[model samples]
Target: MMNTWITASAVAVIAGVTGFFAVLRGSTFAAHAIPNGAFAGAAGASLLGINVIWGLAVFAVAGALGIGALGRRARHDVVTALALVLMLGLGALFVSVSTEYADETYSLLFGEVFGVSGAEVLPIAGLGIASIAVIGAVFRRLMLASAMPEVADARGVSTRSLEVYFLVVMALATSMTVPVVGALLMFSLMIGPAAAARSFTGRPGLAMALSVAIALVTVWAGIALSYRTNWPLGFYVGVMGAGFFLLGRCWAAVRQRRAVASPLPVLPNESGYLPGLIALPCRRPCCAGRSAVPAVLLCRPLCPARASAQPAAPAAPDNFPQKTAAGLLMARRGESSVCDDETSDVWPQLWPGSRRTRCDGFRLHRRR
Candidate 1:
């Protein structure tokens, strides 16, 4: 049981990390294909009387490289499907040639995690850590290429080279995970947690952390539940992965609803511009300007002349068309935004003595 835990956890970490990149790059089909199709390699190795791990690694890496070499950047899935078909056909050939059913080779198709030997645990964990280290070294460059391949290529980032390296690492990780979770259903364990984490968070580092954590929890729960219920471990892993993805979708939907409920303030229009108007610093201890902005709330109106002769004006009401926010002054089109008081400096422009005047589009009085 302890050995199973160690091996499963290590494999889960590798899958979770690589799955994030897989989702970003839209290489999900490849993720699923390589591990399952590589079963043929194990079968072939069984026929040759050699270690099955070597066979798995060789075919998986070869498939990745072939896909990289033969497929165009945007059309890799077509080539991936062709490779999967070929590998599965070869697997059948290998199995048919043998005189007896190879129990060990067949078990690799579905994970035999509960029967893991203690000797294999340390090596699996070590390989997982090494793979993670390599991924981290190129994490930034890979992220750029996956998210914006055109931009990365335009900047001379060598996106093609990056894809090859990334695919190679993915193949190696798939090899490691194949024995623990079975080739056919391994992608469920890898992709589910990763897709869920991405839905929950946009930051790459945080999403990756969440992906690893979710994968561990899913694997642990699967093993424990499978032990008690005696059901297939893959069944639990698939259900748990699907459930997490749905939960993440719910969270994202809720956030989107909240955003719609409260829209940001609109930008100022031409009417908001206080044209040709020079602002005199208010020395008047007024309650607030016409806008009622917080800064001058305890102070006074915008003009300095009002406070010396009379009490401060009240804070502007919400109904006032003038708004002193959003980096613009607001008012009705063709209206002066100053007080009507006769003694005010800006007021003269509003209502000149007996004569009609226009103040910043304000028609103060009728023409004589």
Candidate 2:
């Protein structure tokens, strides 16, 4: 039981830390692939009468490199799937050749945390610490690269290098974690807490802290519950992982609803206008792109969606376009933009002729 706790705790910490970056980097698929590919390593190790960790590590690193070499955002999953197929094929060959692999194989498939020896705890803990330290050193750079690639590029961060570094780290962590949580359940443990943390706060530091805390709690609770119920620890861990993610989704939904129900008031500038809020959303039946947000909440006048919407404009020229500005503004007139008032500088934004000086920019076409 003590060995079980120690080993599980070490693996949990590794999963928690690497999982945060995995989710941030959008490498959750890679996370799943690395360990699945490493399954063959465990089989080969058992056949050779060697430790499973060494086998898993070698194959996991290879899988990570293969993915790193081929992966790109647009078609990353396809590459990951290819790696998975190759690894699984190798695993099948290893399994079919061995008659003594049944018990060891089942243990690998479902995890046997209780069967872990005291000798295994030290290596797992030491390796877990090393992985965490490496992650912490590159945490900020990785976050920038993952969240804002353009900004990272401006700072001279190599996105390709970061991607390969992260995948290798994840591969190492997954190899160690598979012994405790099983390959099938390890991905859930990695993604669950980190994804849930993302919902509560967008700050990377706070979310990482939350992810670790959640993972620790989930592992501890899963162990305790498994002990009491005499059930498999991996099952409980997998369930808790999914439950935490769903809870995060529910929390995010609630926060979003509250924000919509009582929106923050936009402050009025000296000109009683805001730059991005210059025009109200279009209300024409053809303009289905209008935001669902209520216009009254964002600006002074009611939205076109409301029956008693305000009139076109007010007497004060300071608030020139007013709220129903888009309603009155013409989208186009021949080659240039059109405006209700010729002198007003405001024009329909994000259009071809939006920068036109005035509605008279183009002459009306005449059939000669």
Candidate 3:
């Protein structure tokens, strides 16, 4: 049982991380296909009395390379068709062969909880660690390349090499998990935890961490339950992993909704330009007048004379918007003096006296 726990933990960790990368690469279906193809190879290896892990790993690497070669053309239909043929045809072939190992065959097919040994756990753990190391070494590069492959190519990032590297890591990791988790349940082990993590956290590192946590919990919990109740371990783990995803999404949605509806303090320089408006310097990050922001917040009522009469604070940089926090638009040196009615109508609505006045649809107005 202890050995089984270690092996399962190793498999779950590999699956969780690789699955995240699979989703990131838009290769979720490919993740599915590789395992199915590997299972076929494993069955064939069993028939020939060859090493099962080696057979599956070799085939998985080849399948991953093939999928990578197909690249953009590896569509959903293609992946599904290939996976179906590999899974069913190999199972049928394995069944037709006479074997003293009928129980072993079924165990490999559906998986067996008690089958994992202490000897097996170390190697699988090594495989998982190696896979994670590869991912870690190239994570930043992968993220950059993935975000803009064309740009990355232009910048000499070798997008093809990175793709091949990721595919290889994915193949190794997926194969490593097969014996412990079974081909059918492997994709769930990979995709579910990562998805749950993503749903809960926007930060990539935190998301992956959460995925590993979820995987560990589900795998261990499933093991405990399976041991006690004699239920199918794979089925339980898969279901729990899926449950985590749904729960994370729900939690994230609730949090986002609360944030969107909650009113908070805003900055005045957030507005771009109202016909009678000007941009202001907002001292707050929470205020809207950030550089590159389309809209800015401003003071609603314009009282330039009053504003001028009031004590002056430290002047912001010359590049700062000429609007005051109270919504008075200040004239810039050697700039256009014309103010139009069209600009006045476009500001955002604020308190009773304050409305979004448009300065080229960029300025905002705040109440005094």
Candidate 4:
């Protein structure tokens, strides 16, 4: 029982860490498929009377490479499905031929945490340590590649190589987890805790720590409950993992609602406006003449023209056309010929007899 607990705890930590990256990289389907694919190796090894660990490692690495190679042309889900079907079929074929150890085969599909031998502890710990060490070494590169592969590539990070390395590490982690969690239920431990952690926090490091802690709690609680009720460990683990994920989602939703209801801080310059008030574009004909102000003044009076005609209102900014004020004043006075040189060129085409004035560069002549 002690050995089983140790192995399960180590596997949980490894899975939790790897699962964080798996979710970030959008490879949950691959994570699920790889364990089942590696199960083929266990089935074959059982038939051949050899160590199942070597077989699992070999098949998992092969499957990872196969998926990576095929993923170039096809979608990852398609590639993963094809690989899963092929491996599962092979496992079924192997199981059919083997008459002895049928119960062992069943245990492999489900799990036999209670049956863990003392000798298995060292190897499991070694594998878990190795996986953690590799993850730590490539943490930054993996994060960069997972978030934005194109940007990582532009920054001279070898995204392709890092992807292959990550897949290999994931393969190792999957193989290590299969014996404790079973091939079918391994994805629960891999994704559930990590996903819950992500829902609770946006920071990657904090999320990872939370994921590991959640996984540890889930595994320990599952083991305790299984021991008390004589239920399957995997069942307890799955239920608790799912529950934590739901709790995290609820927490996140509550936070979001609180954020939406809270008042936003006003900028020092925007004291007159209420917090959270959106400033809209002034669309009155007077303000519409100037396109330089993209969007300005929220729900204020539309009579800026009357104020502009007076001396108190400042002149339009330099970006505005120089003739805009004259045009507005002329429109008010019921007169014309306020066209600037740029406008004069266009005015002649519009009004055939228009003449350009030297005094103010106004075009006065109009069509008869």
Q: Model 2: runs farther than 4 Å from truth?
A: 72-74, 260-368
Looking at model 1, the pairs that clash are 286-299, 286-300
lDDT digits (tens) for residues 19-111 of candidate 3 = 777766677877777786777677777778898888788778877777677665766448545755766476567756835545655555457
TM-score of 3: 0.67
lDDT of 4 by residue, 1-368 (tens): 99989988888888889998998788998898888789888879878989888879888998888888888778888998999888878888887888565667667767888888998888778878988899999887787567546435544788778877888899878776687668766778888999888777765667788888999899898888998999998898888889999998897666544432112122213232211112322223333212111112210112343333333433333332223444323322323453444434444443344454444555454223
- Which regions of candidate 4 are displaced past 4 Å? 260-368
Between candidates 1 and 2, the TM-score winner = 2
Q: What global local distance difference test value does model 2 have?
A: 0.67
Best by TM-score: 2
Candidate 1 to truth, TM: 0.70
Off by over 4 Å in 3: 72-80, 83-91, 94-105, 261-368
Q: Relative to the true structure, how large is the alpha-carbon lDDT of every model? A: 0.68, 0.67, 0.62, 0.68
